[model samples]
Target: MNVSRRDEDGPRRVVVGVSGSLGSLAALHRAVAEAGRLGAEVLAVLAWEPPGGEFGYRRSPCPPLLAAVRDAAAGRLATALGEAFGGARPAVPLRSLAVRGQTVPVLVGLAGRPDDLLVVGAGRGLLRRGLRPSVAAGCLRQAGCPVLAVPRPALQHDLDALHRRHFWHLPEEPVPAR
Candidate 1:
């Protein structure tokens, strides 16, 4: 926990990790709200890597492919911000970053100032846990400033259950016309 007041780092900032997931969208909203309350700026960051692992990229080293991948990532970040803010500017000062790297390290590095508040979505299932490390957990451990791990929205769980039911071919009640 950083107890120091804001100084050379400029005004306080709310740095959020955004990945276009429902949980990340929730975290983005929360970060914006927190920034409003704190009179701070909101920095939305989206981290991505090449299609293949870093080692694979190093082996091939195709500049065009890498450029394409980075463009795609920038597009995704724009789409996410559009979804989060509905094409309108946020009330607070807003900035965005689309970087190439691991999510945890990128986020931790950007929110390194003591007055920075690092926000990330907190949600993981058995399958997800097996697949990748949790960004929230990593930020919590590595960030120099305070970390805000926003819980996954209830609707996300409901949607996941719906997806599972659909995948299993389970019959669900039909919806009536509005």
Candidate 2:
């Protein structure tokens, strides 16, 4: 699905990867806000892999299935953009693309231009390194352009909520006052 498009020769773009995760949405928000400030465009790219097997970042061997998957992913990107911006479109031009591939490779590809700014989310689970690296971490390590890895909003985490509740409900110690 396409988001928005402007002249090809426009200024550099702020490229963002959205995977429907809370962290990705946060990164999208940051990208849009930053793009507005810089008078740049937002290139929102969403990547999707098929249900099974490793289909490298090329034309899907099975086009029919891949088409359906791409459709779903694009639809998701649209919904996510709506939610992230809350009807407040960015001041700068915005374009969204849904491509098939792993997040890191697709985003790294998009950031090939020297002026591109890549933004990704940074909420890999604690201890997740053994299992896998986050897309944000991977892109930051490999991409040629500057990368901004925005973690999901702190308030979205359970620990933060628990801390807020605990603080609000704390028992007060009575003190004798003269």
What are the lDDT figures for the candidates, one per model? 0.93, 0.83
List pairs with backbone clashes in candidate 2.
none
The whole-model C-alpha lDDT of candidate 2 against the native structure comes to: 0.83
lDDT of 2 by residue, 1-178 (tens): 5543334445788999987878889888899888988788999999878867464424447778777888999999999988888878777799999987778999999878767899998876465656876787789889999999897787568775696799899999899898
Candidate 1: tens digits of C-alpha lDDT, residues 60-152: 899999999999889998999999889999999999999999999999999988888999999878899889988999999999999999999
Best by TM-score: 1
- Which candidate comes out best when scored by lDDT? 1
Show the lowest summed lDDT stretch of 10 residues, model 2. Answer: 1-10
Cα shift from native, residue 6, model 1 (Å): 3.6
TM-score of each: 0.90, 0.76
